[model samples]
Target: MHRCLKIPEILLTIFQNFPSTTYFLEAKCLVSLACTCRDFHAPALDLLWYTLEDLVPLLRIMPDDLVRGKLDPSFWRQWSFSRPLVPSGFERFDYYAPRVKVLTRLSISIDSLTLQDLLQLSSLAKLTDLRMILPDDDMTLPDVQALDHDGVAVLPALLDLHVVSSKLANCTALIQCLHRCTLESINLTLQNPPSGRSLGELFMVLSQSACRASLQSLMISAHDELSHSDEDIVYSTVLAPLLLLRSLYIVVIDNSNWPGLDGKSLQQMVLAWPRLCYLHLYTFELGTTHHSLVTLEGLLPLAAHCPNLCTINLGLHASFKMTESLPGRGVINRNVKLLDFGHSTIDIDAVPHVAGFLSDVFPCANIISTWDEDEFEEDEEDEEIAMSTAWDEVISLHPVFVIARHQERFAY
Candidate 1:
C-alpha cells in the first residue's frame, strides 16, 4: 500500500514540474484529478485560478466559447466568472479586490467603455505598463481625454505607454496628458490623416516637452493621404523636434506625390537626428521615373546621416535601375544588420544589380529578398512546366537570399 500511495505523490510532482504547460491542458488535468477525490480538488482549483490570473486582455479575448462550452459539468460547477471578469461597482470590487495584485501588465485594444470597466475592476495605482489601442471611431477622442484625466494620477508606476492609430484629432491634448504622467518610454504610430494643423504639431509636442528626455524610442508615420505641399510641411515640422531621439522610424507613402526633399533638406534632417539607430521606408508607385527617382535620390543623403543605424527596411516598387542607384557607403560601412526588400522580382538581370547595391550600401547586412511565391513561379518559369515537379527544383535552385536565408524563416 506504501507503493500505491507513492504513485499519486509521484504524479503530483510531475504535474508541478510542468508549470509551463498550456492553461487548457493544466485545467483539464486538474479537473480530471479533482473528480477522483477531495484531496486533489484543492490543487486543481489553485492551478486553474493561477492560470486565469496571468491572462492578459488579448488572451481573454481569444475565441474560446466552444472550449468553455465543452468543459465537463464538474469543472463549470466550481468555476467563477465573478473572479476573472472585470468588476464594476464597489460590491463587485470587494469580492475580487484581493486578486487585483495578480495583474502586473495590462494591454487593451478596445473602446472607452471597456477601458472604464478595466480601470474600475483593477486599481490603476499598481500598473507598471499600459498599452492601449483605441477604436477607429470619432467618439474616441473625448473618451481618451476622460481616461487621461481620471487615470493619469493613479498610474504613477506606469513606465511605458504605446498608442497606435491612423488618425487622432486631439493628439496634442493626448501628448499633454502623457506629459502630466511620468512615463519612461512611449511608442506612438500615426496612420490616419489629420487636417487643420499639419503633421509637424506631433514633432513640436515631442521636441518641446519635458517628456522628450525620458523617451527612448519614437516611431512616426505620416498618413498616405497628405498632399505634396502638406508632406513637406509635416517633415519640416518634425525635423527639428526629432534631433534628440535615439531611435526613429519614419514612413512616407506614395513617393510620386512627395515633392522630393533636396540634398540640403535631407542633410538637415539626417544631421539633426544624430542618435537615430533604425530607419524604415515604404515607397509606393516607383515606376514613375521623374518623381519616384527624385524622391529616392533624396533618401540616399538621409541614409548617410544615421551613423549608428543597424537595420533598414525598404519596401519600394522593384526596379533594377533604382536598385543600382541606391546609396552604398554609410549602410555598408556602419555594419547595418538587416535589409528587407518587399515583394520584388529578383531576376538574373535585377539580381546582380540588387546584389551589387546591397554589397555597396549594406555590405555587412544580410539582404532579405521576399516575393509572392505564386508571382515568382509565374514570372521566372515557362508556362508549360511551371506546374510540374521540375518547377519546384528550378525555383529552389534560385539564390533568393532572404534575410533569414531559409524557407522556414518566412513561416508565420
Candidate 2:
C-alpha cells in the first residue's frame, strides 16, 4: 500500500467511477479522506469538486463574511432580484467554481445567493457539462425578465448541456448564448409549453451554430418532437444542420400532439445522416387515430443505410409492415442491444412474430414493447412467458435475444 502511495493520480482515478444506487457515497468518502491528512486534501478535493450534484451545495459552502440574503429564496411564494449586483466581497464560491467542470443543479433553488452570486457562475472557464433543473416553486419566476444581458450567464466552454425547466426552456437569449459555445451533447425537458415553437429558436441556434460539426448527441423531451421538411421550421433549422449526429431522441414526454416527425420524415432523416447509432423517434400522440405510424417495411432503409444503429424505439408493430427484412442485409449488424416497440399493441399470439422479426433483422437485439417501465412490473410471470416465447424463435439461430427492462435514468 505504501509503495503505491506515490501515485496520487491513480488513486484519484480509481475513486471516480459512476455512482449507482449510492451516487453520493464516493463523494462523501472523498470528503472523509480529505479530513484525514494534508497529503489527501488536494487530491480528494480535486475529485470532489470535479463534478457537483447541485449548485446549492457549492453555494452552501460560501464564506460567512459575504453579504447574505434575508429570506430563504427556496420557499418563497414570490421573489424578484432588484438588480444584478457587483458584489464587494468574495468567498468559497469563487474558490470552487473553477474546479466545477461538470455541474448539475436539479431543481435549482438558489436560496442563499443573490443575483450577483448566481451570475458569478458564468466566469467558470473550465465548466463544460452543465445540467440545470429549474424549480417550479415560483410561477412568477418565468415572467421575471431574463438574466442581465451582460454575459453573466454565458458558459464559455460548455460542451454538454441538459436543462429541464419551463422557464429556461423558451429563453431565446440562453439559446443565443449556447450558440456561441461548441457543445457535443444537449438534452432538454420542458413542460406546459403553450405554443409549438417554444423551443423553435433553440433548435435554430443549434442548427446554425459553429458547433454543428462537433455535436454528436441530442435529446429533447418536449410537448412534441420537431417535425421535418422545409415547411417545418424545426427540420430546416435544427435537423438539417445536424449532419454528423450519432444519436437523436425527440419524444414528447407528456402525450401531446404538437405534431412530431412521421415515418416519411424519419426515412428522409436517415438518408441525411449515415452515422446514426441510437434513435428514439416515437410519435407523441397516444390515441389510435394517429397517422404517423411507421410500417416495419419503413425500417429497411435504416437497416440498409445506417448500419451502425445499435438501439432504436420507433414504436414499431409487425402488422404495419408491407414487406419483410431484406434478403441479405449487406450492412454490418452492429449487435443492436435494445429496442422500444411502443406501438406493438397487437394480439397475444402476434407478439412472437413481431419480436422474432425484429430479432432476425437486428440479429443481436432485445425488444421493449413499451417505454413505461412499470407497465409489466406486476405481471412478471406473464411477461416472461410472452417474452421468452418470442426469443425462443430467434435464439436457436441468432443467440442475442437477451431483453432487460429499461433502466431508470438518474439525474446528475
Candidate 3:
C-alpha cells in the first residue's frame, strides 16, 4: 500500500473523488472498502450513510431478527415491521443515525411507528437537512414527547426544513418536531390554500421558534388557485410574525391572495427584512384583482432599504408613477440584476416609462417576463403576447437608458 493512502485526510479525499452520479454503484465500492480493513471502515461508513434517501434503509440496517421489514403493495411502497418496536432494538439504529446529515422523503406510517418508536428514532443529533412529503391522512409528531430533562431537541442541529403537503395539518405537526435548533432556511409548498385557522397555527409555531431570529430564507407557494376571490387568505396580521426574522434574505410567496398587501405593507416588508437579496411575490394567472395595491413607485422603498437586493419579482400594477422626481438623480440599487413582473398589466406605450423607472431604481436590472416559447406555440391569449412584447421592449430599452444615465452622471 502507498504511504500516502495511510493518511486519513488523503484517503477520504481519494474516496470522495469517485464519481457520484450513481450513488448505489458508488456505495458498492464503499462497501468493498469497508470490508477491506479497519482504516477504511469508519470513513467509508461515514460517507456511505451521509445522505439517506429515506429512513427505510436505515431501519433495514438493524438485525433482521430484531426488526423485520414487510412491503405492503396496496399503498405507496409502504414498509411495516413484523413485531412491535422497542428501545432495546435501537442499538444499531443509534450507531448510524449520527452520520446522516441529509434525509429526504421521510414519511412514517402512523400504524408502523408509536410514541416510543419516535423517541428512539430522535437520536439523529447531527441531522442538518430534512425533507418530508407527507400524506394528507393522520401524520403527526405531537405524541413524540419533547426533549429530555437535560434539554435536547429531536433533530437538535437541523438547519434546513423543506416540506410539501396537500394538508396544513401535516405541516403544523412537523413544525412541532423542532425544539431548540436555529434553522437557516425553510421551503414549503401547499397543494391548496390553507384555512385561516391552520395558517394561524403554522405562523404561531414559527413566531415562537428558537430559530426566528436566525432564519435567512422562506418560501411559501400554493399549487391550487382560489375557488373564489373574496379577500386575501394571507392576512397582514397572520404574516406579521415573520417580520421578527430580521436576518431573512430570501422570501418567495406565490399564487396566494394578498389583497391587504398594499404599498404600505410593501414598505413595511422592505424595512423589516433589510437584508433581502431575493424577493419574489408572484400571483400569475390569478388576474389583476389578486395583484397587490403597490404600483411601480413602491419599488423605491426597496432601493432605499435593501441596497444589496439582487433579484426582484413582484405582482404590482405597472404604470408611470413619476419615478423621475428623485432627490438627486434617484437612488440606484446597482446590486439588482433581474426584475420579474409576472403577468402584471403593462401597456405598450408605457414600455419606455417602465424601462426608465427601472433604470433609475435598479440600474443593472434586466426585465424578465414569465411567458415562454412553448406558451406562444400553444396560442396563448393575445393579451399575454402583447404584454410579453412590452416586457421585451422594456428589456431592450432598459440598458440604453442605463447607459444614458451613466453618460449624464459623467457629464455632471
Collision count for each candidate, in order = 6, 0, 0
Better of 2 and 3 by TM-score: 3
**Per-residue lDDT over 135-196 for candidate 3, one digit per residue giving the tens place of the 0 to 100 score:** 76766454524444535456767788877777777877777666466888888877766555
Regions of model 1 farther than 4 Å from truth:
1-96, 109-123, 140-154, 164-166, 170-173, 182-185, 188-198, 220-234, 244-266, 285-307, 314-334, 340-358, 366-412
Each prediction's Cα lDDT score?
Answer: 0.46, 0.52, 0.72
Candidate 2 per-residue lDDT over residues 1-412, each given as its tens digit: 4756547786676656535356478778888877987667777788888877556566556544433444432232222233444453335667777777776433333323234544565666657777654554432222113454444545667787766555433333345545657777776665543233444545556666656666777766554433322334333234443443333422222223324444566677677667777776554433232433455556767777777777776643344232454322334354567666553334336544454455446656665544243344453546434544443443343343323211211221
Where is model 2 more than 4 Å wrong at Cα? 1-122, 135-153, 167-172, 192-196, 222-260, 320-334, 344-356, 371-412
Worst 10 residues of 3 by lDDT: 70-79
TM-score of 2: 0.55
Cα RMSD for predicted model 2? 11.8
The candidate maximizing TM-score is: 3
By lDDT rank, best first, the candidates go 3, 2, 1
The C-alpha local distance difference test score for the whole of candidate 3 amounts to 0.72
